[model samples]
Structures are given as structure tokens and as C-alpha cells.
Target: MRFLRNALLALAACAFAARPAMAQEILRDTESEALLQDMAAPIVKAAGFQPGAIDIVLLNDPSINAFVAGGQAIYIHSGLIETADNANEVQGVIAHEMGHITGGHVIRSSEGMADASRISILSLLLGAVAVAAGSAEAGMGAIMAGQRAALGKFLAFTRVQESSADAAGAKFLSDAGISGRGSIAFFDKLMGEEIRHGISQDDDEQFVRTHPMTGDRMSRLRDVYSKDPAWNTPVDPQLQSRFVLMKAKLEGYLATPEATLRDYPLSRDDEAALYARAYAYHKDARMDQAIAETDALLSREPDNPYFLELKGQVLLESGRPDEALESLRRANELTRNSPLIAAIFGHALIATEDPAHYDEARQVLRAAVARDRDNPFAWYQLGVVYAAQGDEPRARLASAEQQILSREYARALMSARAAESALPKDTPDWLRAQDIRMQAEAELERSRDRR
Candidate 1:
């Protein structure tokens, strides 16, 4: 389990950060990602941005943080979702982040340089903290102690940007027909925490450090929202229900088994509780109990793709690859061929270790990788299929693709070079091999320079 966790952490690094040294670990959960999209899409459109213009990135960090970096992308911490009571609170945050993007705050800042690697989460957070501290010097002092006042001014510019974002975000929420109450309440709660922590002078929490809490900002939010009719509107009950279910699933996977069980005892007996308990049991390696709980979920919503996906995932991990196929296949069908499910299904096929399944595994995995090019696991499985078929060059190319996605540049370089030498010259595969070789070499050079 630890090995799997570590490998997942390694693969979590996103391809968006193409710079070899600037990889950001991302969590890829279809349900969570889909929910985030659903919440953000309307607010994003309301903010006068094209739907395809912005991208949402989920981080596995437990910290309650979210920021915009790399221009259009929003990086949200898992802790934010787990801690928020409802979807509106998170949607509110997304709306604000979108404001940053829409207000041109992200692109206008020095952090949002033309180079993707320069647009970092660290810079965004530091800018926010600087704004909160209300001192250009204090903000720069934390990182660059001896810089001139100009650098301080540069960092301090974030205050105006933050204020603009707050106003813009409020308008977006109203326009989207969502109550800004969630945004206001969220800030109110954060301010309360800041006060409690300030009383002791032990320093502020990470959130407080990054997002400066001010009475004026809070008042502005309240004033703007109070005037809007949507301020009194309640969140959609259906959205609220989905939010609860998503939170329970996250808690189950992220929290300890005991903690999950304690929070979601059998007597609770709700679908969300059952889902949480199922994950807890899976983590504890109680296969029968886990499957039984999953069955309970499936029995309630027989055609639900997520429940089927979970059951298939557990079965696959528990060494019942054949049994995993049915559920995963059904899930793939129901979900309109989700790349994640397809990838997992391909993995099950490969797990059987039968040469007869290799051809089908290769086809399925190829389709999965085609859909999600950043999926290193799918690429790895495709390489396995290729190797099983005695196609060394294709295997090496796929292996190189996997290593590149995993940010193992040295290994990728070697594999790409091997593929390059063995494949037909000037062909698509050879050209791809050349591209990998160049990227990997450049990455390796950067690493050496860092040393």
C-alpha cells in the first residue's frame, strides 16, 4: 500500500509544468475533477471567460489553500474540499480564483511570465501573503531580506489585485445566480480563525499567512452580496447532496480507517456513509467487508458508474482482475468511456498476464493514453503490452513516454535514444523519439546546473 501510495505521488506530478524541476503533484480523481468542473463552469462563464480558457488542477495537499498559477490554471488543495461544509463554499473560492484570472491579475503580475515554469504556486502564495501582511517589506523580508524597496512595491501590488478579485468574484457569483453568502461566510469563518490564532502570537495558519483577512474586504463582500437578490438564495439541494457524497469519499481515502469508521458508523446507514466505510474497509484489506459495503451502494443505484468503478478498483487491487473487468467494463460503458476507467480496465487485462489479452490490452491502453496523454500508468501498461508482444522498439518508445510523464528524465532519455536508433529513420515514431530525447536532455542539463 505504501509503495502504491508513493508511486501515485510520483505520478501525480502534472504535465502542465513541463519544466523538469517545477512539477506540481496533482490528484486525479474523476469524481472530484468532474464535480469541480461542474461547480466552476458556470462561474467561469459568468466571469466573462471562455469555458476552454481556464483549467482546474487539484492538489493532494492537506493544506486549506487554493491559488491561480500558470496563467489559466487553478490549483485547489484537497483539504479545502474536505473541510468545507458544502459545495457553495468551494465554488465561491473557485469564483474568486477565476476573478484573479479574469481580472488579469495573474497575467499582469511578474509571476505570470511568458515562461510556464515561472508561473508558480509558490509565487502566487507569497504574493497573497504579502498583500495580507500589508507591507511590501514584510513580504519580501520573508524571502529576499535585502532587496530594494522596488521589489517590496512589486510584491505589494498584490493588495490591489486581491481587492479587485474580491469585488469581481462577488459580481460573478451574483451573475451565476449563486449566493455570495457562501463567500461571505467562508471569509467570516477564516477571519474568526485568524483572530483566535492572533491571540496567542504563535503565528498565523498557512491560510491566514497567504490570504490577508481585513475588515474592509469582509465588509465589501457583505455589502455587495446583501444588495443582490441571490444573496438570500439557497444552494441547490441536489448539488448539496453530491457535495456531501464527494466529501465522504475523500475522507474515506485520505483519513485513517478508524477515523473514517468513527465518523461514518454503520448506524448512520446513508449512501455516503456506506461509500466511506467501503473505502475504509478496502484500505484495511478487508476485501469481503469492502465488497459487501460496495454492493450495498450498487444495490441502491445499480447503474451508477462511480460505485462500479470503486468496486472494480478494489477488486483489481485485491488480485481479482477477472472479476474487476465486469464492473469496470460496465462503468466504462455507463460513463461514456471515461479514460481513467479505460486505463484501469487495460491494467486488469495486463494483470491477467495472458499473451492472448496483450493485443486487446494494447488497443485499450492506447485509446486511454490517447485520451489522457499525461496518464503515466496507461503508458506504462501499454509498454508492458508492447514488450509482451516482442516489439522492443515500440516498448522502448512507450517506456520513454511513461518515464517522461513520471519526470524521470534520465531514464526517458536513454529509452528514447534506444528507440531512436532501432526505429525506422524519419518515421513518426523516430521523430517522437527525437523529441523525447531533446526534452530529456534539456531536463538533465537543468538538473546538473541545479546541482
Candidate 2:
């Protein structure tokens, strides 16, 4: 379970499967994800981490929360995303998580997790610590779950790490062209709210009880925010859009399409709200409505990557593969190195009538897999494409890899057997996975000769 969950994390939050075909559900929409990319760019560049590998995901629980688990991914609860009013407040949170990763908080702390069937529970426990160490913790139960004595005596140690992250995060913001107030003001907001909300709800953590949010600290932070060198740079425009898109997506997911449509900007002029309602319509399978909404949106923002991607998706679902391809191709061009776009393109190629398009589909999926080795959709699609290409050996290999990603090792063995039948008798990659595959010819020959 740790192995599987960790795989998704390493892949930058592609998904997690609690059941077959229902695997890791992407929590946020493409727009918010793109916004997170914008928020992540400067901090990652400053920290020298791989850009695009670190994404911010919103969990659905309403309790104010944000966390970073699985090394490179940041998880923010939808509650937190909706709770923050402006971009800098959110960037402040991003900076804190960046602090944790930059300071080696994850590697130093997570070296101790053990494997068991209860690995999911353990990973949850350990993952919380890693997230806290990463310099951001919100959501319900984070503080208590992490600081619990049963968990460890680690929070005291983690507090030092947190302080270091706070200092480093401030520096990261200064270097990344954002203000310290993005960081300071965010803490201030939490502190400010806690004063009004006051005291734990039945579900709230006890750790927050002892970790007081003092007026003096907030005042000092405000003073620092005013004098901080980083405040001159405004929040990125893209981040603001993502903020709206995330709220809109979460709102759509939690509520009704009627609610979304009813609230959609009264004007035909509001593209952002229009796009949101289109997604809501798509979710509702009101295909004509969704297509109409997207068409109007595309008319206004022909080059907008998010709108183009949505239009392509609507086209595909509406059974217009040819049109989907054109729109998807444009979307792909607008976003560099996006696995989601590649996967959509792969689907487009495979659906087309051209026989040679299978290879094109394979290549696009391969690119997606290369970008995120853990994206099961890319690996699964590649396996299908390779099989269609009559490259049973490669298809088998892809199948096995996908199985590994999805925790279906038994089926992986089946794929390996079919693949090995078509390949040269031996290869190193095949040999490494030999124990897990069906018995092959050389092994059979060795058994017969020994007998």
C-alpha cells in the first residue's frame, strides 16, 4: 500500500485508486492545477527543485488544512483554497511548504516508515509528519494527528524544522519575487480568524490549543510585512484564475449544476464563470449545454489553454473525435510538457480511423509516461497502443509496468507472459522481472535437461 500510494506521490498527484478503474481521482480541475504551477514556478526555481513535479492539490474536507506529502506534492484542503480570499495569502502557504522541502524535512524524517497491510494508516500518520515538516499544515486533525504522543516525540524536533522552514520560506519568497506579507499576512489571517472562532470544535486538534496564536507575533509579522523587500511583486495573474477555478470545481463537485448555472455570471461576457459552468454542465452530462458553453468560451479566448482543453474534452465526450483532435492539438501547443494533454491527445489518435495513428498515439503516451512515470492512464494506454501495433513484447512490458503502478501484480504477470512469447529469448529488463513472470522457454529447457 505504501508502495502504491508513494508511486502516486512521486508522479505529482496523478491519482490514487481505492478500487479498480476508480483509481486516484484527480481532485482539482486543470485550471487550478495550472494556477498551482504558476505559484510553484518561482519557488521551485529558487529552491532548484524540478518545476511541474511539485503541485498543489485540494482535498475536499472543510477544516482549514494544507499539507505536503510524497516528497514533491502539496495537498491543500478545498476548504483552505476557498477560505483564502487573495492570491498572496495562498502563496504564503505555498512558500511555507516550499520551506519544508527546501530544508530536507521530508528525507530526514521519513526514513523510518515500516511496511504492513496497515501501511495505509501508517502512511497517513507518517505522511502528516512529513507535511508538517514541509512547513505547512492545515485541515482537520493535522496538528493533533501529527503531534500525538502515540505518534512520536517528533513534533518538538519538527518544531525546530518548522521554524527553519519559516525563516527559509521567507527567504524563498524574497528571492521568488513575492512579498513576505504573502507569508506574514497568511499567518496573520489564521491568527486573526482563530481569535474570532476561538477554542476547538469537537473535531479540532489539541495541539493548536497549546500552540497559541499571540497578538505580539502577528503585530511583529505585520511590521515585518511592511518593511519586507519581497512585497513589491504582485501575485501572479494565473494564480488568481486558479483560485477561482478551484473553488468553482469544488463547488461544482459538491453541489448541483443548477446551483452553478444559477450563479454563473449573468453576463455572456464573463468567460471565467462561463467556463466554470461549462465544466459543471460537462459533469452533469448535459453535453449540448456543455458544448454550447465551451463554444462561446472558445470564441472569446481562442488561445486560452484551459478553455481549449475543456473544449476538446467536451468534443470527445460529445462523440466528435475529429473536432476534439483539433481543439486538443491547440491546447497541447499552449501548455508545455503536460501529461494530461498528452493523454488526451493519445486518446484522440487512437480514436481516429487512420491505421498509422496508433504509433502516434504510442509516442504521445510515451511522452506522458516519461514526464510522470506513475500516471497509470498513460501506461495503460501505452500497453493498449503497443498491442495494437502488434508489438506484443512491448505491450506486455507496458502492461506489467502499469500493473505495478496499479498494484495488480498478478495481471502484470499475465502481460509479461504474452510479451515474452514475442520477444528475443532474453534481455536484462525482462530478466529483472523474471521471478514475477510466467516460466519461459529457457527455464523450461533447463528443467527438462536437469530431469
Candidate 3:
């Protein structure tokens, strides 16, 4: 409910508020994530990267922006998705970011980040020392200076990369057989905003601050869309429908219940409307209404895995884990064992507290982790089950795996070392222990160097 998690891989773990306060927080929603992946698949492949290789992260911020960070991952704001009229708009944004990745823009930027990190550490340390000495002005100045320098280095990209990404993104959409009209439309929207508000030297919006607009940029995009055959193509109806449903769900979860009702009134009779209302009801603890809405969806699409997953989640979260089991089990079966769903299923099984079900829970969690190594929740749950079964060494190793995936390097190293000492040498578990210990140690060294 709160979030899952990597060393750096875990840096992007389930939605967490970035320390030192960089952004609102990250979020993890399986349904929304599935929609994003569906839209991004063709675009990522067109950009010459395996779709699975690029992680799509949903940020909780309500700002219209998208960017690549920490390598290979695309972070898109929930506001952008909610604001988009259709799947193509979101996909266009994704393609553009992918263009940056394929263009090696992020890699080029990392060189500056390395230097910036050092400067940031030094400045922060000096600031802390000054503050300890009661020199408030000096401390604040040092902190501000460091932040400005780091930001300057980080944002030193030219308009050239932006333009090139625009062109490359359009090509990717065209090659992938998706219309470039959405991309053009989005740029047009941004251009209109720029015209109305006028450019600010210090615009607060990340997108506006980073992406400079120019007549040439606008003309280039228009040219790309105007001449392309797919320019006028409509988004796939199924994809558009899914996008609508996804947006509705986000509104239900992220917005106030009254706001959700106003936006998705009961007067509206659609699958998406019902789905949104279900989440709203669930959020408000009106279980009867929530269950009714979920059942309505189930009546229409009995085998819809997402609906079933939602039903299971609602029941589990509502303290009816026993009742949740059937829905979750069926959902997992229907979806071919989605790790996210399985993780939840495993949770339900563990919550039942039936000793008879412990092995089954372990089995389910093991399968889930095997399929998705980045799922910290699954790893953590697996650790719990191991501990419950009196498998101390294995439990510690599982804990280490979860910690490592969570970027808790020092804690992970201690657990891994303990597991290694307790477990047999050269065995698979021992070998994994060795691997985690080494990785944790390396990360610890890097962390020290940064300080």
C-alpha cells in the first residue's frame, strides 16, 4: 500500500519521498504501470531498446513533465498522464524521452553529475560545519551555492539535444506505426503556454524550465507531423479506452472523494466510470458500494484480471484476507501469475496465519521474485516466510536481498555476512550471499567516497 524497491536499481523503488526533498514522491500502481508499458512497448522497441529493459516510473507529482533519470528509467508525472487526452499523448512523451536515452543524452549528462555530486557533498559538509558553529548566514550560503552549482551542471544541455530528441521521437512513432499527431499536439499545447505566460528565467515547472521553446522547434515538429502518413491516424480504440480507465483510477486514488464524484458522477454509465467509482468507494471504506461496483465490472467482464486484482486488493486491505484469497488466486491464474498480484496473493496467504498455508505462500512468493527481481515487497515477504518456517540462514539471506534491492547497503552487507557465516559454503544460497555482500561493500565504498 505504501510502496516495493535496488542498489541504484532500488533507488527507484516503490514510491518514496526522495530525501533532502527533490520531488513529491514516486508511486507504484500496477494497473497504471501496465497501461504505461502497453503504450511504451512499440516506442521503446523503435528506439532500439528492449521494452523490458527500460523501466517506466510514475511520479506522484501533478506536473506535466517526463524525463530520464538514474539511467534507463523514464519518470513521468501523474499530472501528465491525467492531463493527456489519449494514449498517444502519453506515448509521444515517452518516445521523446526514449529519444534522449537512445541519443545517449543521459549518459553524456552523467559525467557532469559525477562532478556535481562531489561539489554537493563538499558544500553540504561545509554548510553543516558552519551551522554547528552558529554562523547561519555562512551555512545557508554554502548550501545554496552547492545546490546552484549542481543544478547548473545538471541542466547544461543545449537546445540541440532537445530538437534532436523531438525529431528522433517523431521518427520512432512513425516507424512504430503510431501517429505523430499527438506529439505535435502536445508541443503545440506547450508552445501556447509559452506564448501566454511568456518565458521566465526561473520557471518552477521542470518541463518548462528544461525544455526551451523556439519557432524553429515548433516548425520542425509541425514539419515532421504534416508530412508523415500516420499523422492523421487515430489512436487504437482499445488503447484509448484503457488510458481513460487508467486516468479514472488515478483520479479516484489521488483526488478527494468529493472531487472524484464530481469528475466521475454516477450519472456516467461506462466501464471506466464504474471502475473509478469502485476505487472511490473503496477509499471511503464504503465496502458495500465498492463491492457492488466491482461485481458490476465482474458481471460484464468476468475474466478481467485487473478487476479481479482490484477486488482482491480491496478485500485484503479491508481486513478480510480470508475472503480475499479466492479473488486473488483467480486473478493470479487469469493473469498468468503477475508478480505484483502474486505478491499480494502471497501477502493474503501469510496473513491467514494458517500453518498449513505457509509452504504455499513461500512457493508463490518465490515464483514472484524469480519473475521480477525488482519487487522488494516480494523479497521482503519471502524473507518473512523463511523466518516463519525457522529457516534462519535463508531468512537472513532473503532479508539481505530485500535490503540490497532497497538500497540499504550497509544493513544488507551485515545481513549477507551473517547469512554467509551460517550457511554452507559454495552452495547457491551462500553464493548469493557472497554476491550481495560484495555489491553492498562496493556501494558502501562509493557512498563513503561521495561523503
Strongest candidate by lDDT: 3
Alpha-carbon lDDT of model 2: 0.65
lDDT digits (tens) for residues 160-200 of candidate 2: 55566666776677778787666666676676677678744
Clash count in backbone of candidate 1: 0
Q: Give the top-scoring candidate (TM-score).
A: 1
Off by over 4 Å in 1: 1-24, 111-155, 199-212
Error of 2 at 231 (Å): 3.1
lDDT digits (tens) for residues 1-451 of candidate 3: 0111012212222111122213456677677788888899999898888868888888888867787754788888888888788898888898888887888775564454565566777888999999999999999899878866655444444344667788889889998989987876777666666677875434344332334444556677778777888888899898898899999889888888788889889998798889889999999999888888899999999988889988988988889999999999999998778899899999999998887889999999999988888788999999999999999999999999999988899999999999999999999999999999999999999999999
Candidate lDDT (C-alpha), each: 0.78, 0.65, 0.80
Cα displacement (Å) at residue 361, model 1: 1.6
CA lDDT, candidate 1, residue 124: 46
> TM-scores of the models, in the given order?
0.83, 0.71, 0.80
Cα misplacement distance, residue 224 of candidate 2 (Å): 2.3
